[model samples]
Target: MNINKQKMIRNVLEQHSNGFYMQTQFVILHNRFFAGTHVHVMLKINNHFLVEHFKYIKLLQMILILELIVFKIAKDLIQYLKIK
Candidate 1:
């Protein structure tokens, strides 16, 4: 992947973690099955309120995080493959 693409993907993942929808989360995680990165770091100040304010949203965030991590890995892999 190009640097711009990597940046775009990272930005998307960050946003997904910050604000997530359940359906989107499912797609992300499913896509991750093809990635290598298994680590996702997200710091959200409102994360705790997610459960009280919206249970579904909280679950979606979790799913999104998983997917984002995988996506990050996949993006890196693509970049590596291109170089080779």
Candidate 2:
């Protein structure tokens, strides 16, 4: 959600050995997930889909972990609580 994280995700995807399709899908999937309920999109993916997207999976893991940590640790939470 933040610029730094977005930039980092982009870097990871861009640097991947896979072709452009996966990277483009990565961006689309990320936008779709955060745009609404990511759980739903995740549920739609089967193991076959996972295998298809295997290369991006690790990067997705990193993005998800970073996202959770950011939401938990970022000062944006203070703004939400009007604590600033």
Candidate 3:
């Protein structure tokens, strides 16, 4: 995975709303998944796990989407600034 995407995923996994347990599990699960396969597999596994973790799936999905969107925007801004 690209470094930015990996960092974004790490950030998302680290995010906590209530306590440490949920975030810890998120990090561990992400680590286990990534350890076994490549980035493509990680994306597929993340999508599947999100489907199974339905309660907060919507929230997680939104966060992931926003993270990507922000990354794209940042990249664009950097390119624009560099062109000036």
Candidate 4:
């Protein structure tokens, strides 16, 4: 994805995370399913928040595993990112 799209998506996630109801976390997680931008990439970015918050580690791990199974190619990349 180009920087603009990346920014747009990250903006969306950030908006949702920030409690702005303009979009939903489900939108990022679903990510147009096989269309538009890649869901794994957005989730990858979102993972940063999950990893940084120790209290949410288990949830973070769950998302990581889900991404691995669902996104296939992202498994190695996410594991390589220190999701542990």
11-79: candidate 2 lDDT, tens digit per residue = 764564233223233333354334443422121111112211222335566456434433343344466
Q: What is the C-alpha lDDT of each candidate?
A: 0.40, 0.40, 0.40, 0.38
lDDT of 3 by residue, 1-84 (tens): 456656666666556323322322232223333334321211222122221222222336545543453445456657877999
Task: Give the higher-TM-score candidate: 3 or 4.
Answer: 3
Q: What's the TM for model 1?
A: 0.31
Q: Give per-candidate clash totals.
A: 1, 0, 0, 0
Supply candidate 2's per-residue lDDT for 1.
56
* Native-referenced Cα lDDT, model 3: 0.40
Q: What TM-score would every model get versus the actual structure?
A: 0.31, 0.30, 0.34, 0.28
Distance from true location, Cα of 62 in model 2, Å: 6.4
**Clashing pairs for predicted structure model 2, backbone only:** none
Q: Model 3 misses residue 17 by how many Å?
A: 13
Off by over 4 Å in 1: 1-57
